[model samples]
Target: MLYAAINAKDHAVYTLSTVHSWRISLSISPPSPLPPSQMTQEQYILASQPNPLQRTGCAQAYPVGIYGWRKRCLYFFILLLLVTMIVNLALTIWILKVMNFTVDGMGNLRVTKEGIRLEGVSEFLLPLYVKEIQSRRDSPLIMQSDRNVTVNARNNIGQLTGQLTVGSEMVEAQCQRFEVRSSDGERVLFSADEQEISIGTEKLKVTGNEGVVFEHSVETSHVRAEPFQDLKLESPTRTLTLEAPKGVEVSAGVGEFKASCRKDLTLESTEGDIFLNANTIRLGNLPHGTTDPLLAPGTTYAKQTVYEVCVCPSGKLYLSPAESASTCQTTNSVCLWS
Candidate 1:
């Protein structure tokens, strides 16, 4: 690099050569700055420069404050910044006036004297969970839908306990069992399940405005029926007794009437006679309880064979074998119970 060394007293100039990396120090040979008297103002300024050989035109000429085009650029930048700040402040005021912002509310929802009012439709992307929802005016909460509405009761584990679905034409419920309870919640008015259905408070009475009807047979603990069809009653393991307060009647006018038993059958009447009214009476194989038999007039043996039924005069019965079976006809000798 080349630098000019000027002698102020003679106005002579000298050219000095040095490398760019070395410091620009005229007093480097002696390690002391030059005395102020022999140095002119220009030479003193030239020697005091730390980078005298590298000149960047006006920057090196006037080194303190911004000057010339750079000064103009700094002023223009300050003006532009002020204008930008003014424009931003104006826009901010305009937006505040247009939007009418408030600190107490958010967005379009505003708090008024009556209640809170939301301007647009509020859509929830996720499930809205709330404990209780009610009207502010203490009225019933009215929710209307075009098609169906459903309500579900869930446990803490998110398992559904019950579900009530109401459609346009029908309403359905899903649960294990269903019961209609009384107003006081004491008794069940109606209950239903897969097994049985019960009604009333102990007794069930049908008003039968259209008459009670049974399409098929009904079997319960005490009463049973086959409706208007044929019905039969049988005892499988125990004895069956038919009793009534007044009388028990069994009528088979057009059909045959027959009765048989696996064991012995006894018919006893305490106040009335057991009348057998038929055109003909038939008897099967039987034995009679008797001790004496007729002597056949010649023999005197009491060995009775084929003892027949005989009626006494007192209407009491005792078996006797005369010449033939007789109700009360006694020709030779009459035997009566003693």
Candidate 2:
């Protein structure tokens, strides 16, 4: 049998004979190409050695297919980085624009170099501390409180011009009292309690469209009116009483006075004099006959005879003639002499 072998070191081919058990060396021939499975160690080592010209920092060159896949992955990463940067920049710009619009678009509000200006209904929920509050307009400004509102200024003053109306609503004040006082805290100019309103100053004048009514009694120390005017007391269907602990006096200057009662009139003097004065004196409704004999002194006549009489200044009674008796007595408080 003939067998061939290759030298691992020199890559030389050799022939061998196994029947005689002898090895024969042939003439050196160039090694033939072998399959990868049959490749010598020298050939494997030569194939595995890197090419000096192509050698770099990386160990070896990649295959063509894998190199293409690496290129595609690099491109995808760069594109992803650019898209992320653009999205971040756009988001930042949009956020800044939204903030600018919100700060500038407030109605009736301005931010200037001098200060801030607030117009129209401006309300504050938090506590606002300021030096002063003032109104520049000439029209009336109203401040109202639903419950109670207090204004405290320690080192400043509050001033109001024109008419001030307090508690104008029909509802009363919650505190039930309103007062105006001077700086000294002693004098009260005006005050109102629950039932009474008082003005403590010099003069008070009240004019009501209807009539002023005093529900209870009215008492004063003194009352005086100027000039001559009629003081009238009227009660349509009720009793009007005037009572005094001391005494009541009425004086009319140079005016004629009269008193009349529709029912009955009485003149009573408890402890003083009742004086009736006029230019002339008259009496009526006297009894025709005197019951006492002393009242008709020295006069004797029949029962049917009537007499007209008069009382003279000398304290004597005189009788008229019989014809004038009926006529003189019929006239009102007049004595007709015949």
Candidate 3:
């Protein structure tokens, strides 16, 4: 090997001696880091790059990421909610449509024709108005319904004004007069204006007048009158009369009342007053001191002394067993005792 030194301008003017060796060695140093300002554009871009796996795996979900599953769950939940809301809205609309109703001037919804259907009325969502409401058939306008019929109204005021018949009984009613006729030729007449009611039968004719008002509830069954009036009752053959306080008036038809009260009794007529007469009789409890039975034969105990009673035959009253004497003597002994 030879070593030489020379000047660029004068290569022959500057020269160096050379030495030759048997072995030649060369050393390589590690490369230096390039300064940020001095680095090439490619090097700078590569050095500042984000992780490639992070970017790619997020864009296309890998097994480790839950992005895809969460999206699917969100969509399914939204769809289920939408379906449920739609169904609820449909049901609400149907219920509202079925319940729609209105009332007429007579406070009635006259559905006389057959095959007519109504819904939601039992729910009472719509207003109801009438005096008394009942579903009835026998009129040409209304067909007989085997199905359970329901009538919704405030009261049956309008329906009671016309004639109605059930079985052999005929009912004639108006704003004031109410009549009921039986199959056995019995008839009952009631009037609103006059405090009088009449029930006609083959064996007996019961008549109630204004005086009967105070002794009976105006709403007494089989009889009719203003609810506020007083009542009194009388039997001409028995020559008996009965009276009660203002609200204690009661009427039980036929001989039914005989079982509840005795044949001859006198009680306070009104709250503060007491009226008594020779033939006027009030009722006591059952003859045996037992409660009145629901029903009994007319002459159930005519032969027995089931009750303790005072007798006033023509006002000469006496106390005796029914079997001992059929009549109370009008003798001086009995009268003097009284």
Candidate 4:
């Protein structure tokens, strides 16, 4: 559409009109060929600090920083993620320490759903204390320590039941009674206490490689035999000595008493007269005996033929001929005993 228009009657009259137009523009350029004093001007830009670099013309370059919002946000997110991971790791370690987690159980020790377990021997640089231990089976429970091993047992009410202590120099087992049992668990092989020591089997045998000596008397001691069997005491070398300070007496309740010797058997009194008191007195092996001092003439037995019995004042026996019997009775002397 035309901005200037005429009516039909006026359009025929507008043919000779002349057109007029105008143009507009804006600029901040300096004036041409001005004096240096007149060209002095100032411009203020709201921008960041600029870097020190070569500049040209009347314009300056403000330094470019983290370029855009996306880059700055990316860097900040990365830093935040790193901090979060570090904190999570620190907290996990602290929890493990407080709960006593088995970090050392990486090798021989194991941590499982059931509990903490040990697969093999674990030697610690320091002493180990724990609530329990599972060890080998069917073997002796031997514990070794340089100093000592003490075992104490307590009942449910906290009363002590037994105490066993073993050390470098001494060992002690304290209880009312101590028992030793067989591996088969059939019977008690031996049992002892402060007042009694019992041997449950048929016989008790004590032996040693060199010598077995019982030096002190025991309390409530006994040696028993099997059913209907005899209790025997023996020394294989035939050397045994038993002494009592008081006088000795022998009695046979239901059996005959017998005395045996390999050589001479002598009964002598040092300060009293010898007496034989019995319902009937009978001498054995009268003339056939050979322990007479006067008859020991270094000759064989066949060389001596006849002998007589002599009586001494000290009740000792001697041999004499029948013809010297009357003289033997009057020749009584204590020397006849020898």
Best by lDDT: 1
RMSD of 3: 25.4
lDDT of each: 0.59, 0.54, 0.42, 0.55
Worst 10 residues of 2 by lDDT: 329-338
| Ranking according to TM-score, highest score first | 4, 2, 1, 3
TM-score of each: 0.32, 0.36, 0.20, 0.42
Model 1 ranges with Cα > 4 A deviation: 1-33, 36-128, 133-138, 201-338
Question: How well does candidate 3 match the true structure in TM-score terms?
Answer: 0.20
Per-candidate clashes, comma-separated = 0, 0, 21, 1
Looking at model 4, which ten-residue stretch has the lowest summed lDDT?
9-18
For model 3, residues 1-338, the per-residue Cα lDDT tens digits are 44444433211122232333332222122123468988778766654665333322213311323357897998899999999999999998777567543352111333435423332233344444444444445533342223322342223464433333332333233345555567654545322435567544434233544243233333332344345543344453454433343444455443233323455444533446654444667543322211113322232334454434544444533443344443323112343334
Q: lDDT tens string, model 4, 248-273?
A: 45544565556667887777768877
- Ranking 2 against 4 by lDDT, winner: 4
lDDT per residue for candidate 1 within 195-303, as digits (tens), equals 7767756555444344355543443333423345433555556656677667777765556767799776788898999999889976655334343335343434255
Ranking by lDDT: 1, 4, 2, 3
Off by over 4 Å in 2: 1-139, 144-171, 174-177, 180-190, 194-210, 222-231, 249-270, 275-338
Tens digits of lDDT, candidate 2, 1-338: 66666584545444443333233323334444567897778787765665343323432322223346887998999999999999999998887776554564445666656466555566565446676554437844445555433443333355322223244454433344678887898999899877877777665543444333554465544433335744444455665555568866666677755666678566677888988787896555543433224444454445554556655343334443344343223221222221
Q: State the local distance difference test value for candidate 4.
A: 0.55
